[model samples]
Every structure is written in C-alpha cells, then in structure tokens.
Target: MGTWIIDAIATRHDRSGFSCGQPSLDEFLQTRVSQYQRRNLGQTFVAVPQGEDANNHRVIGYYTLAASAVAFQNLPLVRSRRLPKHPVPVVLLARLAVDRAHQRKGLGEGLLLDALQRTQAIATELGIYAVEVDAIDDSVAAFYTRYGFAPLLDQPRHLFLPIETIDRAIDAAS
Candidate 1:
C-alpha cells in the first residue's frame, strides 16, 4: 500500500493534474469548470506521495464535492416521505477516479472513504441532510451500494448515504 497525503486544493494554482482520468470527467472539467466557478461547488482532494516534489504530484485519485440538491420526488419512497418537499442541501460526491497507474492499489477506496469522512463532518457542522452521488455507470453504482449507499427513488444511478448511515458504517468498521 502506498502512503498518501490527502488535502484540499486551496487555490486555483493547486489544481495541477486535477483532471479526471476518465473522458467524461475531462469533458466536464473543460466545459463546466468556468460555469461552476461562482458556486465553488467543485472541489478536488489530491493524494500525493508522502515526501516528494509537490509540483511533480500525480493525482493518483480524486473526488469532487459540491453543494447540490435532489428533489424529494426523486428520493426513495422511504426517504422521500421523510424529507421536505423542497430541494434539500446535499453534499454531492459528483465524480471519483483513480489514475490508471494506481488502479489496483486501493487508492480509489481510500479517496472515497476520505470523501465520506469529510462530507460527514461538513454535514454535522453545517446541518446538511445527505451526501449524494451520481454514479457514472452501473458498475460505479454497485461500488457505492457495497459501501451502504442506496439509490434515490427509482433513479438507479443517483445514490445517497445519509449521515446516520455514514456514522453506522464508521462505527461498524471501527
């Protein structure tokens, strides 16, 4: 296992090698970065070697967190009824990708776990309701599901893990 130092990209200058390894992600960054700038909705957490030239950093994996909403109508029946009618403030785990070179190193899972931990902390501090993610594909959806995420409503690709769920998972793991 490789030692990774995880930290937020504090400035635009810190965004080196932040492009997604996946093509869809690349396009989103190219076309959407500017439009989404005002909201600062997109965030990147870079993982670097414990001790190396920071500029020579390779983004082994990254996941973006954003302020997002999911309509109550789009939530699962059990969750929907429990939520308010209007859109709720959600922390979106929008995209996550691991570099091809680091494919089997468990780095992807580490990034995800870090994302969840950070989001959960934010939710508690800011009173957000849920941590949501839009899975890029069925396989990605399955990965989140294995980690206790549930599909929102009938939308198989949109999933969420409530703060309680996250807490339970952490407790179980510990």
Candidate 2:
C-alpha cells in the first residue's frame, strides 16, 4: 500500500522475487528482461516501492514495449479505411504483469497509463500509429477494452489503441 515509482528496469532491481500468477511472465522478469533490453528487442520498465535504494528496490510490477507493425488488413474496418494498404507501424505492449501481492492496488492501470504515455512520446519521433497488445485471455482483453482499446477485425485477442486517440485524450486532460 506504499507509494510506487516506475522507471526503466535496472540491473540491481530485485526481480527474482516477482510472481504475477503467470509463470512465463515471472520467468521473463527474473531472467530474460535484461537480455531483451541489451538486444534492443524490447524496453522493460518496473514499478518499485518509493524510497528504495539501488540494492533494495524490489519489482512490484513490470511491462515491456517493442517496436512493431501490423498489417493494414488486420486493423478494424473503421480504423483501416483512411490508412494505406501497407503495414502500419506500432509499439507493442509486449508484456504487463503485477506481483500477486500487489494485484488489486491499481498498479496495473498505472502501468498501462505509463505505457500509453511512453508510446505517445515515442510517436513524436517515430512513425508509430498505435499501441498494440496481444491479450493472454478473454479477461485480459476485457481489461484493455475498458481503456478504449479496439480489437483487430481478424484477431479478437489482438487489440490496439490509436496514437491519435491517445493524443486527443492527453490534450483534453491538459
């Protein structure tokens, strides 16, 4: 229930104790995340208890982002109509998970908003058209739908939120 700070994953953050009720996700955080960052495959960020030092920072939640693309044909008709036929660039929300102990504390939503904000910033320098995610289950898909993500016409589990939509939301908030 303490305050949390989100930042890029650091080598010293204690990731070994993280368990999000998903073994694959746990393993990724504990083992593969640094490799992903080192290879430029993805950028992973972690949420840790506020005030923790370099040696004591314990990851409470984490998410990863990667540059990607989606075929125009895969987009929903409404979103695709005005776009070109070629693949559209995107930022993939490759993975998102919260530790079991911290599951109901709103960290997940905070992590999502953080990811969306980061995507919006990246779009200014890159040609990212949207933020995309492949939901691991129906419940997960519903979680995203509550936040304005729309499913791809050809793949219901594949959801996307257009950068333009995020831009408008950010502007309105401002």
Candidate 3:
C-alpha cells in the first residue's frame, strides 16, 4: 500500500524491469519463477509498483515461500531434547529480493514482514512449528537476527523464528 501492491505473481505483472543486483535472483525471476511454481517447488509473491497504469504495473520485488523441514539433529540440544526424534515441520522463506531501483527504501523489510505475517497465519492450519530462512550472506544473517530470528547452532547462516514469536510481535504491534 506504500508504493507496492503485493500479490501472487501473475503473467501480467510486467516482469521485465526487475534487477535486484543479484544475478541469481534476477535470473531466477526472469526464467525460473514460472517453472518452479508450475512444478510446485515454490510459490513467489511479487510486489508490483502501484500508481502506474493498469497495463504497466512493474514488479519491484518478490519473495518465495515453500514447505520445508529441519532435521532434529540440526536443532540445538536444548530444543531437540524437547521434541520427538524427527524432522521439525517449518515454512521456508526460500528467496527474497528487491529491485535495485527499490533497494534502500524499506522494500526489503516490507517483503520480510509480509512473509512473516503469511507464514504465521498459514502455520495454524498447516501445523508448521517455525519459519526458517537460509541467509545468503553474513549481512543477510545479521538482518534476520535483528528481527528476532535465532541462528541454528550447527549452521549460522540458517535462521529460525518460532510461531510464538510471530504471535507476540503481532500482538505487540496491535
């Protein structure tokens, strides 16, 4: 509602103008997004630039979410001991990117908050225990940590935030 109208990626979202400064991410959107969605590998939500004519709504950013799991062994001892000996169900925040033109203007945070809200809502019906993200770098990891994500003891780049934390944050904001 700021400058974006977020929605599931559609054929008419004007996909040609996105470039997030990451070649892989840019290429993924340019070529792989549709195939991945068709194969059910992931679901991408794109943020289209609002205020433009209906026929020219440009995509400024996007994020992907998908069902995923974390092996019990990967969890911290304190956490792993409390759960049954099995993989924990989680929602994966697979990819998130903002176009270069939209970077440094809070679009990344907006995308992340949207992803967190969606994961929190979907978990109640889907039985997810947590929302997980694999950070692309140290800076990305730090960003998630600031948002209350805990790093995996075995894998620093992998982070998680429990559903309870999401609930608390929403409650606090409300």
Candidate 4:
C-alpha cells in the first residue's frame, strides 16, 4: 500500500511520468495544464502523487472539480422533482484517471472519496446542490453508478450525486 496525497495542480511540479500511459490523456494534460492554468473553468483539474518526493513522485491519478450549472429539467427523476425550477450550482467532477500501474490498489476509489468529501465540505460552505460528473465512457459511468451516482438523462454520459444522498451515506457509514 502507498500513501496518497491530494493537492492542487498549481502546487505540484509538472512530471511527465504522471501519464497513465495513455497518449491522449498525456497530451491533454500537457496541453491543458500549460494553456489554461488557473482558469476558473479549468480549476477542477487536480493531481495526486504517491508521496513527498518530487522526482519519483509518481502521479498515481488525478481528478478535477469546478463550479458548474445544471438544469432541473435534466436531472434524474428523483432529484429533479425535489429541486426548484432553476439552475443549481454544482461541483463538477470533470475527469478522474488512474495510472495503469496503480489501477487495482484502491487509489481510484481513494481519489473519488476525497473528491466527495471535499465536495461535501464545499457544499456546506457554498450551498451546492449536488456533485455532478460526465463519465468519459460506459465503464467509467458504471463505476460511478456503483458509488450511487445516477444518470441525469438518457444520453451524453452525465450523472449526479445529490448532497443529501452523500450526507445520508456518510451518516449510514458512521
């Protein structure tokens, strides 16, 4: 097992080995981190490292969270009926990727739980309605589903976990 530390992308040094061995993701991270650093729309991108060392600080995985808007009409049936007929402030869980080397060691789950906990804390302060994510593929969608995320619509790969639901889960876990 390894210790995983979650921190802002701004504080972390740029390391090439952080790539999950995927050419597209590597290119995207390389290009976006350079071109869009600190943009409000790009604030969600975050990097996770294995430990304190910068040189050998293998990037196990990363995720992004940002302020987003969601229409009530597009939400899941259970959630839509409960919310007001207006746009809601949402924490967008944009992208989550784990390196191939760290895939099965629960690092991905740790990153997700960290994001959820952070979202919960932020929601407490800023009054967000839910944590929303757009899954990159069916497999990713299924992973979120297992964690209680529900689809908003029939397509476009969007899903959400209401803050209340998260609260309930936390309570249940305790």
lDDT of 1 by residue, 1-174 (tens): 358777764333233454545787755544554455457768767676577675565555667788888787887777767666988778998878766666668888898899988987887678777789989889889988988888887578888988888878877887
lDDT string for model 3 (1-174, tens) is 367888898787887878988888999998899999999999999998777788777889999999999988888776677899999999999999999888888888889999988998897788888889999999889989999999877789999998889989988987
Residue 139 in candidate 2, Cα distance off native in Å:
0.9
Model 2 alpha-carbon miss at residue 12, Å: 1.3
Which portions of model 1 miss their true places by more than 4 Å? 10-21, 27-39
**Per-model TM-score on C-alpha atoms:** 0.83, 0.96, 0.95, 0.85
Query: How accurate locally is residue 110 in candidate 3, as Cα lDDT from 0 to 100?
Result: 88
In Å, residue 150's CA in model 2 sits off its true spot by 0.6
Q: Clashing residue pairs, candidate 4?
A: 44-64, 44-65
Candidate number with the higher lDDT (1 or 3): 3
* Candidate 1 least-lDDT 10 residues: 9-18
Model 2: residues with Cα > 4 Å off, grouped in runs: none
Whose lDDT is greatest here?
A: 2
In model 2, what lDDT does residue 89 have? 96
| TM value for model 2 | 0.96
lDDT (C-alpha) at residue 13 in model 2: 91
lDDT by residue (tens digit), candidate 4, 1-174: 246776667535554666665676666565675455556565544445555577544456777777898887887676777678998789998778877877878887877887888888888789899899988779888999999998887565798888989888877877
- Residue 93, candidate 4: how far off, in angstroms? 0.5
lDDT of model 4 at residue 103? 82
